[model samples]
Structures are given as structure tokens and as C-alpha cells.
Target: MDLEATKNLSASHTIGNYILKSKLGESSFSTVWKAENKITGGEVAAKQVYLSKLNKNLRNCLDCELNFLSSVNHPNIIRLLDVFEINLGMMFTEALLLDMVLRKSIWSSSASIMLEILKQTVIYMLSVSIIFHFCKSEYLQSQDECCVFLVLEFCSGGNLASYLQQHGRVQEKIAKRFTQQMGDGLKILQSHHIIHRDLKPENILLSGKESDVVLKIADFGLSRVLPDNHVETVCGSPFYMAPEVLQFQRYDCKVDMWSVGVILFELLNGYPPFRGRTNFQNIKSSSCLPFSQHILPGLHPDCVDICSRLLSANPVQRLSFDEFYHHKFLRIKGVGKYHGQ
Candidate 1:
């Protein structure tokens, strides 16, 4: 019912038809757990959102995530299997009962008795109102205090961030392979007119074994569908965010291309091209993308071209999604013929 209670929840807790086995990850307002279906015995990642903790923007993101994931069936996107909510009223009611029991001794006086009656009456009316509202509306009110769970496909190989940490600066061949897979995923996003405002290595997941990993675009918490192809919301990780977004300018899907460029650069150089203590400093630092001198001369010209074009500070100069997907680096001969482990 509250933050503390939510934190105390652990393995063995059953929600819907799945049993939470362990925590996969968490954020300020949500937690992801590795769960198993009781009926089918299939493993899934259950993302639980605390409805009371969401603000308007976050609620919109939640709606977007649910809507996008539910309608799409792409190999490079996370699959949503089911969604359900568990009401916290029972827990709240139990706590209220305990509080009343503790205060029973103070109700001996006539005045205290009248006060207790009034409190109970108010509680009864509030409970009735909550029940009626829940029945009438599809969206849960903050007062409802329920946990919404999104059961998704579990990627056991972990995210690209961890992979990079384990094996810093992968081979150029590997980087190209990964980029191609990311392009495949982005094509799906582009077709739907969705802007994945938060695109970074940490948000890309690797499924399958190490030798045959499949990259999936994930974490749509900051994503939105843009029919007009532009948005003004300046939200994203600073290191991988596009300069236009950093400068508070309206941007389009090209912003994601900027992030992909950053990822490609990181995969080849072991770090992002820019660094700053703040967004202002970050934008200033991004005027020049620093390709490692030792590695630059060795990289393919096509690779260098794509990386530079995608990281252009001027959105007008940046590569569009179609261009990036069809660039020579991703489509050239022998690009997908990596044999190294």
C-alpha cells in the first residue's frame, strides 16, 4: 500500500497467474521481477508500477508503453504478454482496523465515542466512493493505490550496457552487427511514428546466447507517438541525448539517430564522444565528436561517415532514420560477416 510495504515484497508473492521469483531491476516508482507463469511455466519479466507514485508525464509514458507494446509484434521490440492490477484496499483496511484497535481504550468517554462514530462514517463513505469510482473508470485513481503489472518477455542475456562493461569496445564487426539489429528495431518504431525519446545502450537488451545475441529496443517510459514528427519535451539521458533536445529545441526521430551514433561510437571506442557535468556543458562538448586517434585510422570510412553524420549538432545536418538504416556501414558487403567471437 505504501513505499515501505512495496519494498518488503519479495519472491513467492503471486500476482495474476505468475509468481515473482526475483527482482530484475527497479526505479523510483516501479520494480521489475523475474516471474514464472503457474499455468504454462514460462518465465517473464513482470514490471510493477506504483500508480500512486506517477505524475502526469509519467502516466502518459505508461499509457504510451502499454499502447505501443500491446499493438505491436516485432522481433526487435519487447513483447507484452499480459497486464493486470492488484488493489491495495485490503491492506489499507487492515491497517485502519489495527489503528482502531490501538485507539479503543481512548473511546471510553462519550465525546470520544461520538468522534469514533464520525471517523467510521467518513471512512465508510470514502470506501463506498472509491469502489464506485473503480467500477466506473478504466484508469485507476491515485487514491486506489494499486500495483499494475506488465508481463513481458524476459531477456536473460541482460542489456547492452552490461555487455559493453564486460567486453569494452567490441570489434568493429560486432559493432556493425549490433547496429544492424538496432536499425531493424528502429524501422519498426519509425513505421508506427513513435519516438523513443530515451535511446541508450542501457535500454537496448540482448537476447539469445553470447554467440547469437539479438538486440531489442526497450524502456519506452519516455517514448511518445508523434503524428507531426516533432516534440518539444526535452527528456532523455544527457550523454546519449541529441543536441537539439539538450538545447530545448523541438526535435523529431532524428534524435534517436543521434543516440544510435553515440552507441556505435561507444561500441568502437569504449566511451561516449562527449562528457559534461551538466546539459549546457554537454552540448558545448558535443561540437566535436572525439574519435580515438588510435582507433580512428583503423575504422572503415563508411563507419566513420555514419557516426559523424548521426552525431551532427545541427539537426538539419543529422542523418534521418531512413538514411542511417540504409547507410553503407549497415548495408555494405561483408558487414554482417563477422566471424570473431
Candidate 2:
């Protein structure tokens, strides 16, 4: 058997040098697994994406993910280790061809005509295959069920979203610590001119044991390199999305600071500052930061100041990356030790 055939047989449990153990999470087009490196005996995350399930926009996001993760190395950002592709099987390809023929109501066509259709379909699949960075001629020959696997550093402590769910609101000192790490990561992104359009708690991960867990930013699916000109793409989760993005205005990296503010607010208050059933509702409700009456009075003045400025409705008034990174709130020292509530 050839390499593709070998891959098809083993890919259910293994890919490259990693043996997939259990599923970590999944989305519409991809699944992430916790895997063990066979040679090094280390843990890692294996994110697998099915090419057939991707649309044009999703493909672009995948390209951005691969490009950004491959280029950067930061302690506060998730690291990409390896990437590879696997072909499902020839049987799967034939099944897809049959399904297409049946859908078109051409099942009773002549063998020569069916052969022509099969050839055309194979050509189409191959054309789509070229969009991937790791496309191999041999892998394209299978013409169906190709999966791209991204090996990444594993975070054992789950995401900040789940952490928040388990611990509710965190103390100011802990929240500040998390904010500082996020700032450190954003500094790297700023240097690279990359904007993490999605910066929710779900995309920030905890990577160590309880006593000394470190926060690392993950999930770059919505990230993009901002050029000199602004981009008007209205993308990102509504709750943490910037007001400018929610209003569909042209935006730059300052939009990310707005998201950071939302995350910070959520960290301190146990819920986002704004709640809405739709984007318009979110924008309408977010005209002002609705700090909890009970919690607002107790927060430090600098904390309140930074949050208010970062969450400013106008991007121009919002804190720039440099300003945010060096804000007095993040630079403040000598806070009392925080014991979890």
C-alpha cells in the first residue's frame, strides 16, 4: 500500500507522530483532539479540518491561522508545532461521486458519461485542494475526504470561558494578572501588525496546574494582518465585539482593545458588560459600560479608568495597543495576594 493508503487506515487514531486520545472540542468544520506524541511522550493538541466542509471565507481564515501561528513564538501565545494532511480513502471518493451523481439524477447515464463526470469532479476537488498549504500531488489523487491536521501545544487547564464558568468572578489581583499576560501576547501581535478579531475568554487558555497556571492566547481563526488601510469586515462574537465592528464601520487594531476591555469586564464581574439577542441590540445596549452596582464601587480607580477608556465606543478614543500595554493598571505593583472566592 502507498502512503495515502497507509494514512487512510491509521488516521482514525493517529496522525503524523501523534496518537489522538480524546476530543477536546469541535466546531462546524473542525475538531480538536488531545494527543500524545509517540516519540517524545508529550501532550499536544491536534486540530483537524475537513477540506470539503470549508467555504471561501473559512479557507481564508485557515490560511491566516497557519500563517500567523507558524511565524510567531511568544510565551503568552499558543505555539504551532507541526502540520500535515491525510487522505481518507479511495472508497470514500467513490461514495462521494455516487452521491453527486444521484443528486443530479444521472445515475442511469452511460458508463462513458459517468466516467466524464467522475473526471470532472476529481478535477474540481483537486482545484479546491490547491488552496491548502500542505497540498501534495499524491494526497490529491484520492480526491475526497482530505483532512488538515495542525499540531499545537496542549493547554491542560482548559479555556478561560470554562475557568470563569467554574469560578465565577475573580478578584482584582487575579484579573490584573490575566490582563497583563494578555497584554504581553498582544504586544507580540502588535509588532507583527496582526489583529485577533476574536479575543473572547474562550480563545484564551490556561496552560498549567492550579497553583501556577499561565494564560496563553489561542484560536487565531479570525485573526488577520491589518495593513495601513482599515478593514470593514464585521466579524467576531457579538458579546465581546467592538462597538465599531458591531456598527459595521471600518476598523483597525483598536477594535481588539475594545474586546480586551469586554473580557476584562467579564473577568471582574462574571458576565459581559453588554447582553443582546442581536448585533443591533448589543450596540444599542453598549452605549455605556454597565458595571455592576455592587462591584463597581469596590474596584480600584485605575482599574475603572483603564476599563472605561478601553471600552470607549469610538475607536479613536479607545486606548491604543501601546497605551494599553503600559497603562498604570497593568503596570501597578504591590497588590495584596488574591485568594479565590
Candidate closest to the true structure, highest lDDT? 1
Highest-scoring model, TM-score? 1
- Which stretches of candidate 2 lie above 4 Å from their native place? 1-12, 90-143, 288-295, 335-341
Tens-digit lDDT track of model 2 for 151-252 = 999998999999999999888888898999999999888888889999999999998787777999998877887879999888889999988888888999
Q: Give the C-alpha miss distance for residue 175 in model 1, angstroms.
A: 0.7
TM per candidate comes to: 0.83, 0.79
Model 2 steric clash pairs: none
Minimum summed lDDT over a 10-residue window in model 1 is located at 288-297
Q: Least accurate stretch of 10 residues (summed lDDT) in model 2?
A: 1-10
What lDDT tens digits, residue by residue, belong to model 1 across residues 1-341?
A: 45557655689977779998999889888888999999999999999898878888888989988999999988889889999877655545655766665576366567777667668856875786677566745454565667788999999989999999999888888889999999999898888888898999889998998999999998898888885546888888999998888888888888999999899988988888887889888888786545433245467777778988888888898999989999988887664323232
Q: Residue 228: error of model 2 in Å?
A: 1.7
Task: Quote the lDDT for 331 in model 2.
Answer: 97
